[model samples]
Target chain A: MDRVRVVGRRILCGILLSAWVLLPASGWGAPLAPLPAPKAQKPAQAELGRRLFFDPRMSGDGGISCATCHMPAKGWGDGQALSAGYPGSKYFRNAQTLLNAAYNKRVFWDGRLSGADLPTLVRDHLTEAHFMLVDGRLFPERLKQVPAYVKMFKEAYGGEPSFGGSLKAISAFLHTIASRNVPFDKFLKGDKKAISAEAQKGLALFRGKAGCAACHNGALLSDGGFHALGVPENEQIFQDPLRHITFRRFNKVIGVPNFMNLRADPGLYVVTKEEGDRGKFRTPTLREVAKTAPYMHNGALATLEDVVAFYDKGGGSGPNKSPRLKPLGLSADERNALVAFLKSLSGEAVSAKEPKIPDYEIRKLGDN
Target chain B: MDRVRVVGRRILCGILLSAWVLLPASGWGAPLAPLPAPKAQKPAQAELGRRLFFDPRMSGDGGISCATCHMPAKGWGDGQALSAGYPGSKYFRNAQTLLNAAYNKRVFWDGRLSGADLPTLVRDHLTEAHFMLVDGRLFPERLKQVPAYVKMFKEAYGGEPSFGGSLKAISAFLHTIASRNVPFDKFLKGDKKAISAEAQKGLALFRGKAGCAACHNGALLSDGGFHALGVPENEQIFQDPLRHITFRRFNKVIGVPNFMNLRADPGLYVVTKEEGDRGKFRTPTLREVAKTAPYMHNGALATLEDVVAFYDKGGGSGPNKSPRLKPLGLSADERNALVAFLKSLSGEAVSAKEPKIPDYEIRKLGDN
Candidate 1:
């Protein structure tokens, strides 16, 4: 029985390999380049940032952390259509993957912030009411009370615990989160058999007929530019009253004219306040795309196939839809190949040892 | 400057150690025995259970898992006063630590079930609407749909996915969660310096004047019996209307007479429907007790110090208050020693590698 099973497995493998090789290889383009190694960060600074990132005490309710949404096990993005916010809230947009985020010139879906420095982003996220909801002034004092945090701050920054030092340390840690040397990278580095033949065909389609490289270009596979792709509205948002209120108030505060009139997300228009920027979202990198699902800004597309089909139809109709989006007349095989290529982009799984949080002992006044 | 810093650190360490040793050893008693290792489990069965434990797809929403609330990192509890239920829901009760739970004859604070076998507990937790909210019948079908799970199920149980098989596999995994060899255990095993002298004084008080051994006895430091300790009501439950409704309905369904009139938690009363059983909760094991806070069924106590103080006051006045309750007259030093001893119950940390969840591809009709 064992011999028969082994023979059967070999036959199956042979059939699958032959089928891949038999596919027409026309329209193949030059292989994409590998991602470059990120600059090394100080070990002490990165270590401190890691602990801070996982510490829920930094949040208002002390129940959420940076790792909650950007969990390393889930491709640095919680595999959800929308990120769960503080106990009573939900994010208006899908949680973006943190992989290769350092390569982006701007952060977040709407490209509201121009600087991608870790410290600036950490500070923004820490104090953002929509995120951690921690008061910046009080947060430092809270950390100062914990002896372990105080020690870490002094070691990482050569000073007492402060908001600026915390952000800088956390940023340094974020810089160390770069993923490199994926199978796609090996294929790009002249290893013809690094990825499956199906992936090779998909790579060809991505760069050529599919026109993915028009926006998804460069080592990170994103131009870091915003464009209106006319992605459809996620009706799920209407069911959540808190999310609806937050979305409306956010757009209004950002000076989005006629924000109430918008049937769907105004996207970049909320940041830029330009009518042409309406519904435009920053292009996302495709690194580790296979692990992150429920795609798009609102997570409207459930799968890569759905996303490809949407693009194949030149996206949904909108006033500011990018002209670059046109019907991609790709065959079924080509579409599957494209997905296979994208799957190859996944690198080695990243995991971090959870840091030991210090226990705070309640001391009587003047005891210490 | 460096030499001065080193001298200051040594002085601080000396002061802390000397303070511990200076505590009176008058109440010191015989040390407790170390906890024994759990029986070996079949590797294949446990491996299958580990995978299922971490697979969020097992839940109704395909989001929550056993590990969601019983996170290994936080001592098999989420380190919350109340466990977060399905995305929008909050549990009325705190998540219990699974460490050394196998030693119990009854499960849960209410002691609703007498059986301690893993499968029974797994089934109860899985179908509990306030917990995973997963329908047993549908859950098996969900697992069956996943090819990888089906293969694992077959290997582990020699059958396709079934409700019984899934429960057994998950139970097998739970059996592997036993924690032993804590510092207290090492001290009990004749390692005099395994725990601090303060902890030694605390252990003596626990076994003698503190009267903790009356309930918290045996290898697991729990008598596997119910006791009404008059734990305070968690007001947080009142803030959640759903929790209030669920609590009422659960008590009513269990035939609790005048459940509404009961102050705080009815606890074991709901299960027995005996008026005398009112407010009685099963004694929880002290294994990894330091990691699992706020203490008690309602999670009203915020710290171990608060828990010790509560006991020192001989518990609150209530109908079913244990007759064993009496003021221990423990001094400040004794209280600190007891807290230190409790902290020493924390064993080596346990962590499970996250299993890779297989993606479910939407196939055309009859494609499989």
Candidate 2:
């Protein structure tokens, strides 16, 4: 009977070890996995997109570019809590990272933009009155004047410079921006030693007791769904009159159904007009979250620790707060571990050489 | 008689070539020459300085850095006609390049600060209300909080962080930033084929008919003297109330005798407080002049051609206009050649890697 009992204990121990090894590999109960490679794009098309991305002449004032806010050094998001838009304008929402954005079904914080194609989003951002402030019809003419751009467009699209061609090129470039070979990714791909033991413990907590995997799951660590996390209001917006006015105007223009609280940003409610959808923002991908600080839709939190603490405390006070969020009862060590795990998601730094802009003579109004 | 004529012609040709070479070598009629290598600095000290230079935490709001305006990508100076200062403030003068700045005895366009030692200038820039707005006393305390900075400071200065130490370190780094081995420098060093034929012609014109060498001369291509070039007033300052207010306030604080025309920026007169000095500004170094566009103290000229044209037309209309700036009567070809020569002054691009700033817990107020 003693021999049988000892044999039974040994069998159980072997089973546990096997389960630990197979868990992440099978993706049965794992919270995260390695992000899949994106669809390949033509090198020339992507190259044209890259040039257009950095060209400030794409804006009305010739001062702003796609790279102005989406800086590579700052993890494709300007390290500011709120990004500067046009000269005197400010953005209401925090600038989101372009990394692995092509994997998302929707774009923007509120998910107002639908579908994976990014040209429409690009067009909206370029022509938006408070954003780039460029006229779409006149923009093509500016590109056509640059001999280098004209040549590049011809090579990339087999056509002259046009509005559609510009959009296509930019979108193609966006699709190529994917994160890979991160520490977390290596760990997910069966390398037990890739991440620290503390991080491995954090991964377990992230999937189980912390309950973070409910919303933040899959390869991108986002469900591509909207939720009201009850992020606190940014007080600076209330203090600055210009910012307040810009915010109100933007909401009004977008036809947000509820205007009762002019100070409050009603995230996804603007698009759905559903009373239930109030304060709902899309779940942002956790990839490169360490570098893109001042977290959340309103950028109220300053660091990953603060973000983790907020979640531990079951988010801020609000009527529309997610029911899934509850006090995690996390220890300080667990909090640190979670932060470390999140930081490990940051892959190799993305950088590109600034393209040489083709010099063109400034044509005055009515000059041939 | 035929042999005598041939020998005479050879002698004259030899004499002309010898005179041409000797003229530049003797600093009699040279346009520009090679920049001397700066005294060697401790790599550790310079490395610490580099981190401090790029760290935005040096600013009050943790937003601006030395790299903000003096970007390596944009030839050290930001490619703005006038740079944006502290949030709402706009600078009256254009951002000057930091390249070979250590060689200058005077700093700033107005020459308010004198001497090559950069600590005083560093102090002024840090605490200046319209600039970084950082208090020196508080800045060192901020640096002490970061473990990496504390370690680096100790290694570099052999003591705890201090305001003086910070300044000394930054100044030490700036002293190492010297321009060298430009195309013009190579040409000056007896490489006849180093520069293009057009540039060679331009060099002759620069020393002779153009009279550029009168003010712009020496190894660094600056005589380090003030002159009244009668640069036109920038109308944009008058349009913005905050900028106009800031401009008036800065001049008043600096003790300019007359603030009669708020629009009129009385360059060096703000420092000297003399009638003769009213519109005088320190002649800027022409090294890398082609890259630092929107020329002059006020950035009135957009391109090299515009600058050449301004000189050709004998400067703008002003009471204090220098008598030295007589019309050059340069033709279009000569103007193009002059621009080409100026372009040759730009050396290989200067760049530095952004340092990894150490992360520390964000303490909310007074905390040990």
The most accurate candidate by TM-score is: 2
Give candidate 2's TM-score: 0.48
Instruction: Residues B177-237, candidate 2: write the lDDT tens digits.
Output: 6676688877876888989999999888888788888788866788788888878888766
Model 2 DockQ (Cα-based): 0.01
Q: Name model 1 segments beyond 4 Å from true.
A: A1-31, A362-368, B1-368
Per-model DockQ: 0.01, 0.01
Regions of candidate 2 where Cα sits further than 4 Å from its true position: A1-368, B1-31, B361-368
**Candidate 1 CAPRI category:** incorrect
**lDDT agreement of model 1 with the native:** 0.73
TM-scores across all candidates? 0.47, 0.48
Task: Give the worst 10-residue stretch by lDDT in candidate 2 chain B.
Answer: B359-368
What's the C-alpha lDDT at position A254 in model 1?
76
Error of 1 at B222 (Å): 54
Clashing residue pairs for model 1: A202-A337, A202-A338
* Each model's backbone clash number: 2, 0
- lDDT (tens digit, per residue) of candidate 1 on A1-368: 74376557645644544422322223322123556565467899989989998987666445678998889888888889877764434568999887776667888899887644757787777765457655454456456546787778878888867789888888777777777668987776667898999998888787778888777766677777889898878875654544554465466567777654446788888787778888899988888898789799988899999888888888888879999889988788888998898899988886677777765432122321
